[model samples]
Target: MQEEKRRGQNRDIDLDTLDGQIIRALQQDGRASIRDLAASFGATRELVSHRLRLLTEHEGLRVVAALDPGFAGHHVLTHSMVLVDGPVGPVAERLAELPDAVFVSMVSGAFPLVFESRHGSVEELHESLDWVRGLPGVQRVRVTTYSEILKGFFVSPERRQISLDSIDYALIAILQRDGRTSYRALAEAVHLSASSARARVHRLIDAGVIRISAIKSGGISRNRLAIGIGITARGGTEPIGRYLAVSPAIDFAARSHGNYDFVATLVGASSSTLLTVIDELRTIPEVGAIESWAHFDIVKEDYARTLGRVLGP
Candidate 1:
């Protein structure tokens, strides 16, 4: 292994123990201030801020606020599996450009590209998929609609009854791009006083309308094994879903109403560790059968939303 250089010289700034800890802390609270991070890391506030800036500017790491698609006028969320007759790269890129696409990736398995999309209604989703199926290199498309979201990475499960105006939408759009943006900047972007902008952000967070968390950069090495596991629950999926949610190896888990009762993403340092986690899942009495697929490469992963259409003028 090569010795990693400091100063974020290249896209390969090695994540040391401190860096990992900082990331975990940010995942828990992306809006944490420099003083808070410094206290947690036992470092000076200035040092902590410098490190964070280096990661964001050079290593592609970002902190972003995630919004509930439903709250943003998207009532339907769908998971799609796409098979391409020709090159997968071009097909995957085209899928990513779809307005409703929330997440898209090229994987190793029965499907070459898998993506999650959000829509305002069933008709909209269908039309989007119809256009995708008609794409030149497209061979087939498999769709699985999410009934209820058990967990959505960084988003809260609870729904807010709050109504939003243009100001709120503008603020959300800014945060979606950079969750670490300063209060002064947020106010300037949305044309509000800094104090008022700060207040509104807290209200949104407390209302469970949105959440902020650190996003791991795509430049990060894929040396570690990454897999997607589909699970069939014997009874109600609550128990199994809860169990998987707390597992350290599992990054994403959710209850679904499709071929599987639940779906999860797991990452481990090695194949053995990955297998070990799967073996543990097998031990769960509520788990019936499990299917696993290794992730080949993540072609495009974007969580940002186009608020103008959904939020409306």
Candidate 2:
């Protein structure tokens, strides 16, 4: 029943069309100009511009800057599954309100609420989890601490540590709010020349310190099924982790130390596509077992963390 509803909602946005192509292109490079996008699609600039406007205005598309976890001083990444005593709505709402909660959703399976959170240290991560376990209607919480995040919509696996000054921090803060902030505005905020601001922004992007891309306002995707998978590996986890990380079907993959050796989030146009991916996973010799869950509703998906809060006043 839930799957059918999601399929109906997904049909609203067809990815094979020009709009979908534009979105995919922008996801790679959000700062692409309208002219560049139109040229790539062999479409008129006016049409492309109109479609872009429609996507941002009505289609829940948001172009923003996704900061590297290390750059943001976040070292701990965790995926938690919550089993509620009674109603799951209230518990889910409370979890979604947490500042550290990057992704929150209600899912099918033993756990009704699944959320992902980040912390600056292991102590902070455990403290946050303890608080969640004490929340009203919360029964038990199972957490998987990620040793390394391979892929995510807002997080880049490439960690290029760079020395950032006050001005760089300011620029990052501004871009976190809006990735497409004009060079002039960025210059004014950081008190730098427009050209210098542009140079710094480009440098940061090139250094992999930050990623500017399009992120959907809702869950990972409104037009696809979002499924979470937990895998137990036979040998070492590195090989299996690398394979899942590189797969196009799996957007978010991580190596973790818990019940599952690796956890991955798969997005597909239909259940059959997701099933095919699962079957392929089963065929892998290293994969010993797999646990899968479908997300019924995504309550929150926010990765934009305030630099001031992270860096302190």
lDDT per residue, candidate 1, 206-262, as tens digits? 787778888764413433456787888897676787788788878677677667777
Q: Give the alpha carbon lDDT tens digit for every residue of 1-313 in model 2.
A: 9666545544454444677678777777888999898788766666677788888898777788867777778899889999999989899999988888988999989998899999999999888998899899999999998988787766664666577788888888888888888999999998999999999999888777788888665444545578999999998666687789778888789889887889998876678889999999998889999999888888887777777787643
Which candidate tops lDDT? 2
Clashing pairs in 2: none
Q: TM-score of every model?
A: 0.85, 0.87
- Return the top candidate by TM-score: 2
**Which regions in candidate 2 have their CA more than 4 angstroms from the true location?**
1-16, 220-222
- Each candidate's lDDT (Cα)? 0.76, 0.82
Q: What's the lDDT for residue 53 in model 1? A: 82
lDDT at position 255, candidate 1: 70
